[model samples]
Target chain A: MGGDVIDFYFDFASPYAYLAAGRVDGLSQRVGRPVRWRPILLGAVFKISGGQPNLNKPLQGDYLRLDVPRCARLWEIPLHQPLPSPFPSLAASRAFYWLDQVGGEHSPAALARAVFQAHWAEGRDMALPENVLDVAASLGLERDAVEAGIAQSQVKDRLRAETEAAIARGVFGAPFFFIGHEPFWGADRMDQMEDWLQRGGW
Target chain B: MGGDVIDFYFDFASPYAYLAAGRVDGLSQRVGRPVRWRPILLGAVFKISGGQPNLNKPLQGDYLRLDVPRCARLWEIPLHQPLPSPFPSLAASRAFYWLDQVGGEHSPAALARAVFQAHWAEGRDMALPENVLDVAASLGLERDAVEAGIAQSQVKDRLRAETEAAIARGVFGAPFFFIGHEPFWGADRMDQMEDWLQRGGW
Candidate 1:
């Protein structure tokens, strides 16, 4: 729980999480803190947290259709809404954990951004194994090993375990962050989170 | 639909709305836009929007308990959690519409701030009619007339009608704002709201 480490939990399907992913790494580096990117299945977290996905709410769903693009434009990130919106993030989450096993300090982060960009930026179907593998290959990771690793029992178990662990630690949403056990939720909270770090928590 | 007007929809019981209420006036003045403060019941808006109050979710409730105080401190506002949390805001909303009937450019705005302070700052029981009347009286409005005005059938109906109007306009949460029909929801969107206003929306 050192001040040098920040824990970031996110899901591939969340637009806000995509937004946070783009900002967290740079902010962490600037603030001289290392980030642990813990990719989780928000669907599972929602179940434990008694929260329903925003996509399931008709009004919220419509609002997000407009909001996501607006936010992407505001943040200066290239985003295109996926054809099949709110697709399963399990495979992508699994890829992350699999990559974490062998990747160095920045490899997992690179893969994380690639996954977010593949789905949200390029509108690629990350739910598809081939698409995920294609993204992994684009990141210069071995394709056969990534394909095999995602399908591995331990990798899938690790993703599940991590999601449950996040729930146990009171993570109920995507783009949830923790700096020394102080929780900051949502992409909108990035500025406040930075301020908290600067002031050493008020 | 003039660029000079910003429509602000809020509920008295919402903590985020309280935060927004504190800042919207100054923002309006700075940006040279007029604010139309429309106080509405979030409960009524939620009924049609298929949404529930955030307090109903245990995890979110816990997060808000801490987040509210943190935000209050960050914004340098006086905030004490209301004695009875999630108190009925009907009387307060009705009072606003009643005040709107006779008040000037800043009357409704001032009353909105006073009501928010009475509940969130002084920890008053805003659910009680007497408390609402007390807040109105404190604003230099007549005591007996203010009490009678809040109870007027038209005042009650205006509050109800405004809430329905807000729903019709696609407002699903408190602290919802609009600049010429470009909708923004949540207090966290305040900065984005200002950006949209400044840039005339992207």
Candidate 2:
């Protein structure tokens, strides 16, 4: 990453993350910051935060089932409408911290994009190891390096550590970003984030 | 209203309208369009469209109370935040259309901006005659002409007709704009509406 960097710590289990992956880099670049992609498991983060899935909230399940895709269509983004959308993000999310450790300065952005596309776009099985490797190889990266990263105990620890770091930073959810200690906790603030960055995060 | 105009039909009662009002003009300038300000009653549009207010539903009331202002702050706009939002809006709705009749010819934009500021910015009582007059004065418009226009049966009839026309155009809510029937609802789309003026609403 070049310029003033704002680390965009994210997870593949989120549709918001998919949208952010496409726009975050461009947003940062336009606003004169190079956004650093930091992939971390939200499951671990949730465990720490004690946050409940929004769909499980009363009446929200219907909104997610019906309203969310309507909102996506209005914004002109493609949607698969994940069947079990509060996705079991463990394997795919762990894969990222895993890749970062062993993949030797890997293209975090590319890998993040591939897995986001896998879960949100292709609607593939995230729990499957074959699917994870398929996502890596498709990105023209070595698959064994990713698999090797996952098998290591340190990778698991790093993911946990990163999640704990996010919680300590006061991040309440996935797609959380920061400017110094200012926590903006939604995907909707993307433009404002760019505006703040353009002003050198003043 | 110049160029290939996109009339942003909107209501002050709607929170989304406030968000759109604050930024749509600037956004349109960025997107290269002239956002025509078309003030209309969302309640009337809902009446015609059979659309239910989300507030009537239990869970949505909380979401509205929370999420709407979050969008306002996220977008950096002012909000009134009146509890129960004063259910009946007919008088204010009529007044906007009435003002448009007097101020409609060339400077509808000024008149529309004042109304948005009054309702969303200052949280003034829109039903008060003095408040509306002050809004007119702030726009550097003659208060007498606005007062005179309010007494006209034609203006009132025309406002009712405008509501009917909005319904005919499939407008389901306030701050809904049609870029040649490509509905961009909310005052926030005003920039999009403005751009339609530049790009030809097709």
Candidate 3:
């Protein structure tokens, strides 16, 4: 458990997850733990958890529009206007697993950051496979391999299994983290997470 | 706008609101603003916002059970086990408005803190009117007048109106704060709210 990596569960469609992605590396370095970047489909997780997108909730939707940018500014992370709709994160998420399987230890994390930046920071349309491939290609991964990798049934199953496994572990939201068996949710919880690591639970 | 007091919107049933109640005073002092403690019915607000208690959601409910106590420990606030069910907060919420109407400037805020502590810290059942009155009486308010105050139609109307007005202001949850027109939600957001007040928005 001492050497255990922090499991970071995220959805590419989530802006909070995007924000968490930007800061998690620094958190990892400070805490002396590697992060296991696990990209899951929130739509799938929400289906079982009876949760929905905050963007579909009444007041919460409006708050997100204001808070996300404010948080980005405060954290010094670049962010553009949100997509007209949530980016269809299926391909991007699948691409992450594929990279994790074939690439080096850090490659998947690098790709995750790139994909999050493309959609959130640069306003690229990640719903398009071409754009997702483009982001992966920018990371120097072969575009054809990424396209093929995402289409694999095994890769699809891995994401499905991962999302279901996250639900089994009581994760219902993006930007969720696990330090050993303890769960921490949301980008806002980074401070608490830091404290948890520093004090080993207060 | 400079002279405007910060508006603190809350419900007694929420542990997060209980946590916020403890900290809001220091926040008010540090920001050089008074806080208008407005007790609200999150149940009514949820009806409009299509939100429900975090304790009613699946995985979220489980997370709250662990997180609340952990937060209480981290914040150095005492917390016993939560009530078997949520504390029915209507009568307590009404008591807050009634106290605000007739008590001294700090009395209602004092009552809010006591009620939160009684329920959350001491494991008292705030669902019972007798318990709420007892807590108020302990604060030097006449018990008979407190009982009469909570039972008054005008006080009932005030609570209803405040809850509706909070909904109108897009408050979907407990521990919502407004600095002028800018809104902040959740106990977790206190730091962000403080930053907003000190920097006057980033």
Clashing pairs in 1: none
List per-prediction Cα lDDT, in the order shown: 0.83, 0.63, 0.85
User: Which stretch of 10 consecutive residues in model 1 chain B shows the poorest summed lDDT?
Assistant: B75-84
- Among the numbered candidates, top DockQ falls to 3
True contacts kept of each: 0.40, 0.04, 0.48
How much DockQ does model 2 earn?
Answer: 0.07
lDDT of 1 by residue, B30-86 (tens): 788889999998988888886777877788888887787777767677888543377
For model 3, name the residue pairs that clash: none
Clashes of each: 0, 11, 0
Error of 3 at A127 (Å): 1.4
- Estimate the TM-score of every prediction: 0.94, 0.56, 0.94
Write down the worst ten-residue block by lDDT for model 2 chain B: B83-92
Q: Report the alpha-carbon TM-score of model 2 versus the true structure.
A: 0.56
In the order shown, the candidates' DockQ scores are: 0.63, 0.07, 0.64
Report the C-alpha lDDT of model 2 over A147-176, residue by residue, as the tens digit: 777778887787778778876776656677
